[model samples]
Target: MIELLTPNEMQLADRLTIDSGIDGYALMQRAGEAVSQTIVAQWPDTKIVAVLCGTGSNGGDGYITARLLKVAGYQVTCFTAGRSAPQSYSERAQRDYVADEGVIMPLETFKADEFQLIIDALLGTGLTRNVEGKIAACIDEVNSCNKPVCAIDLPSGVSGKSGQPMGIAVKADLTVTFFRKKPGHVLQPGRALCGVIRLCDIGIEAEVLEQIKPILFESWPNLWGALLPDHNPDSNKFRRGHVAVFCGNVWSTGAARLSATGAARSGAGLVTVVAPENALTVLASHLTSIMIEPLGNDTEKLDTDVLSFFKRRKVKAAVLGPGFGDQERAKRLVYTVLQSKTEDSDLKTLVLDADAITAFKDHPLVLFAAIEKSGLQLVITPHEGEFQRLFGNFVKGKDKVEQAREAARLSHSIVIYKGADTVIAAPDGRAVINGNGNVLLATAGSGDVLTGIIASFCAQGMPVFAAACAAVWMHAETAECFEELSPAGMMAEDISQMLLKVWARLREMATPSPSPST
Candidate 1:
């Protein structure tokens, strides 16, 4: 369930299932049955339903669902814009169940406003081109209806590989997908549109995954929960690991402080905000558990302070580029930190975000070289704008996951491409797409908080890739819990204070519930 398959992979999975002797028609029948069951369960009172069926296998699913619903005594109207007969088992399904006259109507004859529910079976995961023509009009009308929608597999007109709407796509209230999820179910826009997804086991066996190595994964607690920092009962601050978040000047110190607080809240043994001499006051005023270190913006001072920290203290990870302004100084400091390291210590990690990423736009290769030679694990958090500023269409036509992966390969670092659909991609072609984040996380400084959590996890000894996934999942989890509780509105600073809530929940989930006394 964690592994996200591309459209091609999904097809292969289906073919594998079929080859394993499961009837292809049986698979469609199962899909249709699941869709009908989910729809009935979700909207028990709704009697009038519109089912849009295309000419492909997807249309077959709809035709079967329509017939099943009709038998179930629900008023189901089947409409088709199908140019040709249904494909494969769908043709059989239509011939067997949809023989009643006036049961399946032309697509043009259907009216969206009259339906209490809608099922989008017009398209499946195979779409690569943009949606146009009659189907586009149908999607637009369905979106406007505001009725509950249940989409088969994924919403029609969405690419299972990329999650981009094929021009226009169905906005489903409920998406009933079979077996494993596709990328479209997790990647954004499509993710948002696929509301309340319910994955059903439609006879696709799990053993087929042995031959198929899925590249994309869904980021959630299950992936990194065990990797959560193990703090011994007698462990002190030093045992947890120390993290330093480098700050900009006084006016922009808030971002750095937010990151530092995030680190401290996320169980870092010690957290420090490395600020310039002038920014110390601002940082000191806001931070208590997190310490503040003063360093000059000059490269020499940065090198000395960072190298000294690595030598004297156990500085596990250092963060740069939350709000660090001057590009020249950010560049100089990044290079300085990249070059400072200790072989025996946990000083093999550096995290760059915001200004740190943009600082390397002019000569990204230089930064990449520094990362490659430093022998330090590098993690960069950049939103689309920051990413574009640095890579400049390096992955112009690629999807978010691909874009992040390519950037990571080129930069020789872990890339957290931030957005509603956050993609954490490593240079080794491994990636996890975060699906829980909502618009509430778009507030200012939210990413800074995420950066802090990432640095904190790295300091606490998690592998960089797992740490990134853990941090992203925790950030989204916090937002989700917040929405459930207070939800008045959340800010970056508020996230740090709320970490304890999810942290406790994380520990609870990891701990097994006691077996009931028999």
Candidate 2:
């Protein structure tokens, strides 16, 4: 789990390092040198370079870079947006650059086409508001120039915390950041702007995270590998876990079938689909390994069948809502599933997806209350539209991470905001951003497969947040692996078959490679 810091959190870390006796000026010098070295290494032939500086410390780094680049025999044009106050770091840096025979000009004098390379130090991670006036103009010019851009820390105008642009942002060919990555470097529009991210280790130590106690993370196998369940010779079918998937309708049983197949492939010892009475024969014919259970058409009948299944089978996890055409019936089943109890343990897990999420849009608060009262470990998978329907636009302008975090807090469940950059947020403020997904996962019934994989993990008793992160990574990565073998398009069923290779790959990744010996 690579830690991703918010802007405020990074600020605290810097302050702590300074308070503990590290020189702030020394830190700034190392930062500048990193940027300068990267620029020189990536473009050694380029003789002309433009360093765009602003009023803040980001500009201070730019001043130092200009001085270093001058010493390195490069033709440097240094531009400052505003005058630095006297006796400050920015002023000190400017004076040092001038003493080294490096000339500083106003930002208005900057010419985009005059230089072969551009250095963006106008704004750093601290930017909260939109770029305006001269700074905005400089950014616009830099972007329009189409010159090779090297950004210090982050591109100007992109939010370090949420990754959203503040009016406009610099599109950099290379971005040199320090210590660790901010959310902006990995999150979407900002991610697209930062073409290639280079993490340069300055003087700041990663140990400071202990004091910072960051809750956000970038998902990787290390985050959940230790918590994953493994089967041994003594394990039995019932001992591994039992997963139950609810069917949509006779005409639309494919979605549930995809989910059930996914669960079975994910190491769920027993996978079953609870189907409508009319769809039992269809589901049975299609499914060989997965079992089938007949569900009643009405609310009372569904409640009875659902409770009976739990009582007899000791089901560990249940999935609902994929391809469910009737919203009202889906909502009723969700409520019934919430009220379900199992004798296997004190707690039962439930996953809601697609139609199930939309069914609660009219009165989301009621659904939240029911989940809370039932004491079920709940996870809700909602795309942007389903999220808007259930959570409204109160979080309209915030980035995907913040919106998902808020939704988790409100619903008292782990919120999986499904997207190309999927965000998994736990109720306690812990969050993970999944970066492995692609357009290949945009096909029909893809999310249904994801729902089953998550259920399988929960059934196996993997921790909730860890289960969600693992499930999301597996779902996207399986698609990527499938494309390598069958580059032609893939279907929802194909993903389930690919899960075997993905699981083996995960186990390989989790295993430590043997060290070379004498």
Candidate 3:
């Protein structure tokens, strides 16, 4: 269920299901039944419904749903735009619905205000180009009506591969997708358009995944929760992991403090804020449980001081950027972390965010070369603006997931492309589309909190990809938990404070209970 299939992959799944002795029409029936059941369960009082059908299998699902609803005594109307002559499984569904005396109306005859609910089965996941002509008009008509829409598979004009809208798209109140969800269901305009997604099991066996080998997955704990470091009773502070966070100047220290607290709360053994001498007082005043080390004021000495601190403190992971200003010093610090290694130990991992990402806008190749030289386990978190500043030209036409994967491959690092639907991609082309985030994460300093969380995981010996995915999922979970407390009043600090609660919940879920005495 965590695997996200592309539209083509879904088509292959359908073909595979059909080849396995299950009739296509039978699958359509099951899909229709699931959709109808969901609608009835969610809106039991609805008496009138409109089912919009196309000439494809999606229309077949609508026709079957219409027939079932008619049989149930609800006033169901089937509206067809260009589906006068349905093809293949759709034709069969149309024939059976006609045999049952179901009402089929032309698109012109259908009025949006006349129905309590609208079932949009006009386009499935096969769409590639922008929607146009009569289909576009029908989408416009549905959108203009403001009626509650339940889309089949996907909203009509949404690209199944990318979440972007093609020309125009239906805004669905609920989207019922068969089997697994497509990337469009989770990835921005499409995710927003699909208000509430209901994934229905329509008889597609899980074994098909062996052949498909889908690399994309939904960002959830089930995908990476088991990879989290287990708490051992015998382990001491140093065994957990140590994270060093670089603080900004005196006036801009809040972001670093937020990151330090986040690391401390997210199970890091020790959290230290490596601050400039000018910023030490501000950082020390705000930080209680976390420790702070003061580096000299000279920017030229910053790199040497950081390298020395890493070796002396045996820092397992370091988080750079956050509130650090976009300066040459930031670039130097990144290069130093990337190149710093001792006879006894090397800097194994780092989380680069905010200013660190922005600092390499003109010299990304230099940063990439440094990564190659050191073979650092790196996680780079960048929002759209920061991403545009760094890899915008490289990822111009590609979708978000592809952009992240390509970036990860090019830099030989894990890329956490932050947004409402964050896409975490690894160098090997594996990706995860995060669905746990909400608008509450829109606040400032949220990304800093995320950086610390990821750094903590990396410090604790999680694989780079799993650490990035776990951090993104937990960050979103914190935002969700914050929403439960005050939906609109959430600050970035709330996310850091709530990390322990989220970790407790995840640990409880991962822990096994004693079996019953059978």
Candidate 4:
């Protein structure tokens, strides 16, 4: 689980490292040397290189890079942006480059056609305002060249804190970042703009992270693998945990079945699909290992039957939404489930997704109030559209991570904001950005499959936030495996079946190794 730092955190890390012992300029030299080495390795045949330097430390690194490239016999042209004189480390880097006989060109004289490789050091992670005037023009020219570009820290004009582009940004073929990666490196628009990211160690020791103590991490097995339920020899079916999935109407029963299968395959001991009487036949025919229970079409009976099953089976978790229609009845079912309880135990977990999330769009506070009363560990899975509907005016312009964190805080539930870059935020403020998953997961019924996976983990005694992180990573791993067979043709059911393989690998990883012979 690699730590993801924000721009402010990264600045503090650098300051702390310099204060500890290492010279700031020495770190800049190392960064320049690393970038120079990478360029030579990636493009051995390159002759001319254009280095676009800003007026700050990012430009300092570019200056040193230009000097190193010149020493290696490459025709290097250094272009400096802005009218201010280089200060601090950048001043030293410029003086050294000039001593080495490297010519620093003005932005107006720099030509994109003259170079084979373009190094975008125009702006670094500290940039907050939109790119405008000369800097923006320089970025525009570099992008228009269509030549391969290598960014120094991050692509010029990309927000290091948020992954958003500031008006316009340079789309680099490769990005070289020093020390640890920033949130922008893994987040959406910035991740896309940064083609291939290469992390270079520039003399910052690992211990610096101890003082910074970044809360966000890249989603991986090491982050939440230890939290998975153990299947001991003495474990029984009931001990493993039971999951109940609320089915949609007769015409839309497949979604519920998908959720049930996902729950069963994800290590839930028993999975039952609580369906309306009209949908029982379809669900029973589609499911074999999973059980099906019928609740009459009457809303009053449906509420009573669901509560009765929760008490009778000691159900650990429940999944709602999916193909369930978005109507008053669906909203009523959510309310009933939240309000229902067992005599001796509270409803441990619940997953609300798709139509279930949209059902409370107009009055989300009512749902929040019920969750507060029920004391249920809740997980809400919402894609972009659903998130917009549920969160409404609160998350209009916030970034994905911020949006999820705020939503989690407001509802006091784990919020899984789904996308290419899925972010799982807990109410206490810990968040993880999923690094796994592929484009193949964009297929239909994928969210339904995710709903089951998360609920199953929660039912198996994993904490709500950890369960969500594990489910997201496993879902991505399943998609990665499915990609090997058929990238485009694989369906949601394929992912459910592939969970067995993913779980096998996870179990193998968790097993203790044999001790060495004495």
Candidate 5:
């Protein structure tokens, strides 16, 4: 797992190294030199360089970089926030560099139009408060200047803990961050503010992460590879996996069939839709390959006997709550499916969506215990409104990553926080910022398609944690593939059809055999 550290945690990590015999000043020297070299390499044609420095270590880094740039024959002027020098070794290095020949002018003295490149070293990761006074004014100047700006470490005024901007932040043309990328670097507004981020190794040994034990990890294929299901040539329908999607009453039954179709396409050899008796006839008229099972007459309680019929046929996964109405019986069925907790139980993976999520919104704690008792990995797909309804405002945070992480922790299940920038967070502190999806996915019922995609992967025995990641990645990639298609007109069924193409692409990309002998 690649660890992502908060600004405070990063400071503690640096402190830990200092106490372990490495001098802090040595790290600062290496950091400054690294930035200086990176600037020369990335933008050698710089005529005038304006370096902005604050009172902290970030300012120190800028001072050193400016001094190095000056020595390299580029005209450099240093602008300070008109604050005293920092006492730390990191701050001292920057302060000493500016003591000789570097102009110590206020932000007003520099005109944005005058410089070709502006290096922002103001207010690094440690800032926790909102930008104020001259700092805020300088940020406005940088934004208004429209000149190409390169930020050191992270863009100023963006919180490292969450991706939220502290009142205002510097929008950089490029951000050169050291070591690991922070949560801000990948999450929302921070990701946008940090333009074209380049991660440089500033000699912070990877081993130091072991002591800090960062709980957050960037999601990627490396983490989910083992969870990908392996299929044999001799695999039979039951041998692979069987999934049952529960449909709601007539008006709501389509979502369940969509899930069934998605599951069937996603490698589940046998996919069934359990529709309410009234809707069974209507469902049968549309669904061909998917078989429909009618619910028992005992409407108040889900018929365990009827469910056992599928169990006897060796159903391995179940998707509930998609189109199911938020009725008393729907709630009962959710509890019934989760009651089978034994290792040999037919249901090993459960996907809760739409109405199922609505049922638990009033009391999420009820589902958490049921999930633990069921001993099955659980996945919950909720849009922002549904998410807030289920988990309350506690899940709301400054960054989508933070909110999703909080939701995963509270629910004890994988939380697929659906949006144009969908984020999937697992309880184990792993998340993926889906980059492949396009605006075309913003249409209605798209989330239903996403829920089905994840359910299909879960049925194939992908751990709920990894299945969510794979589903999100594939879902987004599929949307990007069909960019020309009208997003406004796209429906859930369209995604069901596209799943196969996305999986084939993923398979081809993952396989590393010698190219065909041409």
Candidate 6:
């Protein structure tokens, strides 16, 4: 897993290098030269460049980049915010460079649009406060210019740890950070402002990532490759795992059937849909590979019968949600499903989504209590509206990732905050931001597909934390495959077919590259 450093942690890395006998000034030069190289590559025809310098080491980086950009035949204009020079070694080098040949323009005298590309070096990772006074005005000017801006290290006023904009921040066209990326580069607002990201290595040891130990990760196939279940040559149907799903009424049975198909397609050995007796005929006619079980029509009868059926079949895992109505009957059904237990063991896994999450809107504590009492794995998938109904209004204006993390901690369950950028958070502090999914997944029944995938992963003996992350990544990757296909007319079944394609691609990456046949 890659590490994303906070501002202070990144400073620790610099201190570590200085302690190892490398001169701080030499490190600054390398960083600045690398930034200069990036500028030329991106803007080869540009003859004018403006570098905004601050009062510290970030200013030093600006001076050096200015000198290097000047050497490459661009007219470089350097601007400084404070009067006194910084005391650091790198700062002294930057001051000396300006004294020799660079044109130091006062902040008030500099005009916007004088340069085609603005390089914002006003603040780096060291900044902890909001932008104010002349600095705020300068950032405002940059924002009003409408020209492309490249930020060094991080955007001028965004927090590296939280991705929050401090008062105001420089919205950059591209943000060139060193080594591994930071949270701000991926989190919202900051992520939206940072048009594109480029990570540069300036002699920082790759091993430094181990010491950082970031709790959040950018989700990719590499992270979930090994978590997928292995299908052995001798594997039997029972050995692979079975997932049982509860269907709603006749009109609402499609969701349950879709989920069963999704589970079956996602590698579940067997998927059974328990439908109300009235809906069994229609469901049976619709499903070929999935088995259909008859459920009693009345809530009390169904509740009593479900437990017996689950125990008799020795079902490995169960999915209860989807189109299950948000009424009292649905609530009773959900409670009965949660209470289902075996003679020798507890129900190890349960997935809740759709109307199931909505049913517990006024009494979220009941959901929490259920989790505490069961000592079983509980996974909740909620969209923004459902999230508000179930978890209350925990998120005010915070980014979705932060909101999801907080929800995961509060509920003490794996929280799948579903959206274009799905964030899955475990109670154990691990979180992932999925980048693979596109708007094509915004269609109806897509989430039901995801619900089935997670249920399948849990049935296959994968831990809830890993299963949640792997399932989310796979769901998103599947949607990305059909990016060109509009989500407008598509149904849930399309995503199940796409899952097979996603599985093939992921499996290829997991397997070792083939060698030539003898």
Quick one: best TM-score, which candidate? 3
Residue-by-residue lDDT tens digits, candidate 3, 1-518: 68899999999998999999999889999999998888888778887999999888899999998888887778998988665354588988988999999888887777889999999999888788988888888889899997899999999999999988999999999999988999999998899999899999989999898888889998777778777888789997888889999888899999998898888888889999988888888777788889999877677776677777887888899999999984677887887788775323435788889999999999888788788777678898999999888888788899999999999988888999999899999888999999986898899998888888888888888877888888899999987788778779788989988887797778677433311100
Residue 131 CA displacement from its true place in model 5, Å = 1.1
Q: What is the lDDT of residue 508 in candidate 3?
A: 73
The C-alpha stretches of model 1 lying farther than 4 A from their native spots are: 83-87, 100-102, 297-301, 342-345, 510-518
Which sequence of candidate numbers ranks them by TM-score, best first?
3, 4, 1, 2, 6, 5
Worst 10 residues of 4 by lDDT: 509-518
Model 2 misplaced regions, further than 4 Å: 342-347, 393-398, 483-488, 510-518
| RMSD, every candidate, angstroms | 3.7, 3.7, 3.4, 3.6, 4.6, 4.3
Model 6: CA > 4 A from native: 83-85, 125-130, 341-347, 393-402, 484-492, 508-518
lDDT of 3 at 82: 66
Residue lDDT tens for model 5, 1-518: 24578787788778887888888877777777888888898889886999998877888788888888888878888888866454776457656766767766887676788899999999888678999988898889999987889999889999886777999999998998888878777666787898888887877777788787776655555545446678888888777688888888888877887778778877787888887688988898999988877776575455565456556767777888876875566678777777765525677777888888888777788888777777677788888788889876675444687778788887788888887557888776666655456676776666766676677777777667767877777777667666655545656677767776776776666533211110
Candidate 1, residues 1-518, lDDT tens digits: the string is 68788888989999999999999999999999998888878888899989998888888888888888887779988888865464567677767665753277888887898889999999988898998988899999998887888999889988888888989999998999988999999888888889899999999988888777777788767677777788789999888889989888889998898898889888899988878899888777777878877787566566676677666777989899988888788888887777776345557678899999888888888888888988889999999899998876588888888999999999999999998889999898988898875677889999999888999998988878888888988888778778877656888878887787888788677533211110
List clashing residue pairs in candidate 2. none
Q: Give per-residue CA lDDT, model 6, range 370-468, as digits (tens).
A: 776666678999987899898757667655666787788777788998876677888766777776676677778888888888888888887777788
TM-score of each: 0.94, 0.94, 0.95, 0.95, 0.87, 0.89
Please provide, for model 4 over 74-101, each residue's C-alpha lDDT reduced to its tens digit, 9 standing for 90 to 100.
8999999853364689889989998988
Clashing residue pairs for model 4 = none
TM-score of 5: 0.87
> Whole-model lDDT for model 3 versus the true structure?
0.86
Model 5: worst 10 consecutive residues (lDDT sum): 509-518
Instruction: Report the C-alpha lDDT of model 2 over 1-518, residue by residue, as the tens digit.
Output: 27888888988888888998998888889999998999889999997999999888889999998899998899998999988878888888988999988988889989999999999999989888988998888899999986899999999999998788999999999999988789998888888888899988878987798898888888777777767787778999887899999898899999999999989988899999988888999998898989998887776577777787887888999999998878999998888788775323322789999899999888999998998888899999999899999987457776788899889988999999998788999888888988775678889999999999999999988888888998999999987898787766888888988898888888788633211100
The whole-model lDDT of each prediction reads: 0.84, 0.87, 0.86, 0.86, 0.76, 0.78
